[model samples]
Target: MKILVTGANGYLGQGIVEELSQKSNVEVIATGRKVDRINVDVKKIPVDLFEVKDPYNYFGRPDVLLHLAWRDGFIHNSPAHIDDLPKHYSFLKK
Candidate 1:
């Protein structure tokens, strides 16, 4: 499965990128606000979720989208748990 990982340079995303890189079953497409990262085993794409047309803009359809972004008083660990604005979630559905 192809996975699009948002906030992939953060704590959870760091581990996710490394773990997925070692696996042959999934392709990890890593994106973050700042592109300052390096893990050659996986393909890295720099995307600032805040500035995009949508958070999922550059990314095409993915088998799974592991959202890891937040707004306002939101915290880490569960960006998906919070109710993101319609424009954001709608992007993923596309």
Candidate 2:
């Protein structure tokens, strides 16, 4: 099965992608703003999720999508989180 994982370069994302990539039946598609930081041996795509028109097709029509991408996650009251709400919604809508 093909699985598309966004935020694949982040701390949690990296571990998830690494674990998923080890599965023999799983085809992992790792996506992030900086995919070079991802250490897993899988398909890597550098993408700005907020700007992608069609995420499903853009990331290669995967059977599943694990949307872990977020900005300013450590900042509890970051304005970026609020600013990106609409973008995140739009990305998920498609």
Model 2 residue pairs with clashes: none
lDDT (10s digit) by residue, model 2, range 29-76: 999888987887999999798778788888778999898888877678
Q: Candidate 1 residues 74-93, lDDT tens each?
A: 35555554556664666555
Error of 2 at 73 (Å): 1.5
Per-candidate local distance difference test: 0.68, 0.89
Clashes of each: 0, 0
Best prediction by lDDT: 2
Misplaced by over 4 Å in model 2 are none
